[model samples]
Target: EDQVTQSPEALRLQEGESSSLNCSYTVSGLRGLFWYRQDPGKGPEFLFTLYSAGEEKEKERLKATLTKKESFLHITAPKPEDSATYLCAVQAIGSSNTGKLIFGQGTTLQVKP
Candidate 1:
């Protein structure tokens, strides 16, 4: 079974403080890794996609990178507006045709101004 684990289940940051969130996983046949940001009571919003080892993507303060067995979401100098639950998910090769994402529990971030 493909499994994902995220560290530091929750984070409290002073505004302008920078940090990185980790997403580690194991899968049968790796296809892709994804990152999303979710606000309370809202669905996740797509952030990035990593397709291979050394592959990376970034948007604004969020940057995502993938290795053979794990991925990381690096947040630089976060603001109060950046506070949200960050989710990590994966798509295993040959797992299904339905485009389902196996997700991690997520790391909730709070940036206090």
Candidate 2:
């Protein structure tokens, strides 16, 4: 079965702190891996999408990288505005051709100034 797992269910960081969030997944076949940021009571905001291993994308203080079995979100000097629940999801081209998506529980990040 395909599944996704995220580490450190919660994270606390000071105003200038930098850290990485891990998203590990297992799928029969990979279509793409996506990253999203969700604020309380709001829907997820798209961050990045990686198509294959060695692919990477960046936006502002966030950088996302992908590998064969996992992906990572690197936050550099995050600010209070960056605090949110980061979500990781994967799309698989299953035998049914439905392109099903599997999501991780997500990591809640808190940035204290």
Candidate 3:
């Protein structure tokens, strides 16, 4: 069965510390992988979309990369403002254009100043 899993469940980093969050997935056919950031009591914010192995996207302190079986979200010198829950999700070809997504459990990051 297709599934997604994220590691560490939670992370705590000192201000200016860098770290990486992991998301691993298995699916019959991958259409896209998406990353999102959610703060408490708010909807998730779109971060990146990876379509194939070796694809990457970046925004400020965050860089996302995709491989056959996994993806990574690398944070560089994160600040307290970067604290949030990071989510990874995947859409399978079998879902057609309905945009159904299978989401990982998420990794909550806390950056302390």
Candidate 4:
């Protein structure tokens, strides 16, 4: 079955601490991998898209890298404002190009100030 799994379902980090979040997925025909940051009571905010293995993207303190079966979100020198539920999703081939996604359980991060 095609699915996505994220580890360390919750994390607590002190401000300025660095960490890495993981997303593992199995899909029949992968079209894209996506990352989003969700704050409480708010919709997910798009972070990155990875289309192939060895592909990587970065924004601010977040870096996303993809491999054949997994992807990683590396947080460098995180701040309290960066705390949020990070989500990973995959879109399979033949699906509509209309921003549809199959999401994994998110990883909730709390960065202490």
Winning candidate number (lDDT):
3
Q: List, residue by residue over 42-101, the lDDT tens digit for candidate 2.
A: 999999999999999999999999999999999999999999999999999766747767
User: What lDDT does each candidate get?
Assistant: 0.90, 0.95, 0.95, 0.94
lDDT (Cα, tens digit) per residue for candidate 4, span 1-113:
67899988999999999999999999877899999999999999999999999999999999999999999999999999999999999998765545568899999999999
Q: Using Cα atoms with residue i matched to residue i, what is each candidate's TM-score against the true structure?
A: 0.95, 0.97, 0.96, 0.94
Query: On residues 50-89, what C-alpha lDDT tens digit does candidate 1 reach at each position?
Result: 9999998888988898899888888899999999999999
What local lDDT does model 3 show for residue 36? 97
Model 4 segments beyond 4 Å from truth?
95-99
Writing each residue's lDDT as its tens digit, candidate 3 over 1-113 gives: 88999998999999999999999999988999999999999998999999999999999999999999999999999999999999999998874547788999999999999
Clash pairs detected, candidate 1:
none
Candidate 3: what lDDT? 0.95
Clashing pairs in 2: none
Model 3 alpha-carbon miss at residue 34, Å: 0.2
Q: Tell me which residue pairs clash in candidate 3.
A: none
How displaced is residue 71 in candidate 3, in Å?
0.2
Q: Give the TM-score of candidate 4.
A: 0.94
Lowest-lDDT window of 10 residues in candidate 2? Answer: 93-102
Whole-model lDDT for model 4 versus the true structure? 0.94
* Best-first order by lDDT: 3, 2, 4, 1
